[model samples]
Target: MTADARDLARWSETLAGIARTGMAFTESLYERERYEEVLHVAGDIKAAARAAADEVEVEREVDHFVQEWMESIGEGVPGYVTPKVAIGAIVGNENSEILLVQRKDSGIWLYPTGWADIGYSPSEVAVKEVSEETGIECDVSRLLGVVDGQRMGFSRFGMYMLLFHCTATGGELNPHPLETGDVGWFSRDELPEATAGAAWWGSMAFAAIDGEQAPATFDPVRDAIWRTDDT
Candidate 1:
């Protein structure tokens, strides 16, 4: 979208207000229908702003504003907010065994990943998430790509995923009960059934194994990429 900075800021503020109100209702004893109505309005406002801006980045910024507002109110609300950031890794050894984890929530396999936190860069978030979820200390080698994952069901609000090719520098595999249920290494041909919403890995696997860098952003909702070749 080509909106001026001031206009984008205005729309972002409005969307944030809507999110705050919805969060407040969720915190209270509001009925499910009422809560859903509020969320729908928030989504509509976001859609309108995005339509005006005609830019994926603009829509993502607005979505982040809404998520920040919801997080500020607290986390009692169910499915009201999306993860701000996430780190996915391609961890392997000389034997080429890729690391995978089973999430406690869905019992599905996935790479070590988690949401971004305040004061952390995307790369930092990725490293921290990998360590926190799987206890494998990794150093990020390169940024493979950033892809929009809203359609993958991986995000509740809206999310941009940063996938990294990383090396396991040290540390043994230790699972965290609060985040992961199991951890292990597997070959590419022996990949496990990933939990729903972990679609980022499938794309990353194709990129890493083929030695290709998908250095463009994807809009999952539209099934289009912001091609580098495009002006």
Candidate 2:
């Protein structure tokens, strides 16, 4: 009977983005007032999610989220709120092994990934992340998937992950001191028990590694776009 914490967070963020964008383009005083009210509601929703997730009583500081959203508002095109982008590499070697890194922050194993850098292309970010996090040099072969990180539980915030299929070119299994706890080649059957989002991406990744020609994957459209998980 209760909304999931993640669903609450998602709804709160979506509402906050809408309010911020409305504030950006509207000059009418009444519309501005309404948008501000929406921001307050969004803040309440976010605070609720935080409380639920932490399993503790949270002080409902609606003003904090409102101020944060208000500060992020920009003029015109830049005001359009969108999910952040991250790039991931599914690097495969000649032995049909995938390169995975144990994230230092979470201790979960996943393909090498990082936030998209300002100057580099998406594919370039994937290559850079692989080399930096796992010390694996790889050439991108093709795109594997474009995944919604929130839906897949890879991130709490809205993020789009550009997953690329890559072939290992060189380098040894040297994990980054700060970013990765460990790094190594793993066969499909040998993935770590703590592998993140394996159900959502495992098949696609291993198929790519095994030389299967499949189109890039994405989340399918929901029948009710705005419906909550409980519905």
Candidate 3:
């Protein structure tokens, strides 16, 4: 089918999902072969739509991604593939400062966040991520928001970010040596540099921190959410 950018992205993501599930669940060699072929076609879809300047390079990159994804495949019961859940904390201190961490790899400042462990509840995960990333003990108050990571362009795969509002209980400023570069509490007026989505999140975050009585924030419905050009 002829495709636009949104169509390409949708096709790529859908086929990738099928390919990954096939890798994890299918024991049949023929099925695996078919899925791998789908992976190649899905990868090339993006290049075909836009990155077509050098098709060969795009193919190489897509192959690399498929290989990496294959390497990271976690074994599961044959056919239960689904989106993963991540947890984040928007911790606020008594002073009304929000807890922030600079990621070691990206150098971007954001609320403390991590993948949710199997045994932990969402609130528990929130508190744990805050403590582990920023050395800040916290108590989760309530769910702040939930975002579709892929839809938000924060992830290539299907995932959800469960963000919780929290109150800092204790602990000193100490960043995780491996996962975090720096960590601290910052008031809205004194936020650090390179904070991801600060323009979209700044006011809402601060409002939550400042004890505002409002509904939890969520991504608004769009006529075409996958399309970048919204008018």
List the global CA lDDT of all models.
0.62, 0.87, 0.78
Q: What is the C-alpha RMSD of each candidate to the true structure, in Å?
A: 11.2, 2.1, 4.0
Instruction: For residues 1-231, write the lDDT of model 2, one tens digit per residue.
Output: 134787888888899889888888888999999999999999898888878877545564667778988999997778888899999899999999999999888899999989999999999998899989987788999998898887766576779999999999998889999989999889999999999878878898889999999888899998876787558
Pairs of colliding residues, candidate 3: none
lDDT of 1 by residue, 16-116 (tens): 54555465555455553464455445555555555665544444454554454546654445434444566677776556677788989889887777666
Candidate 3 lowest-lDDT run of ten: 47-56
What's the CA error at residue 36 for candidate 2, in Å? 1.8
Which candidate, 1 or 3, has the higher TM-score? 3
CA deviation > 4 Å runs, candidate 1: 1-83, 194-200, 206-217, 220-231
lDDT string for model 3 (1-231, tens) is 222444566557677777877778878999888988887787777556445433345655777766765665555654455778999888998899999999999999999889989888889988888888888888888887888776666665678888888998889988999999999889898998788878866887788889986777677786865564534
Question: Model 2, residue 3: what's the lDDT?
Answer: 45
**Better-scoring candidate (TM-score), 2 or 3:** 2
Pairs that clash in candidate 2: none
Q: Regarding lDDT, does 1 or 2 come out ahead?
A: 2
Residue 113, candidate 3: Cα error in Å is 0.8
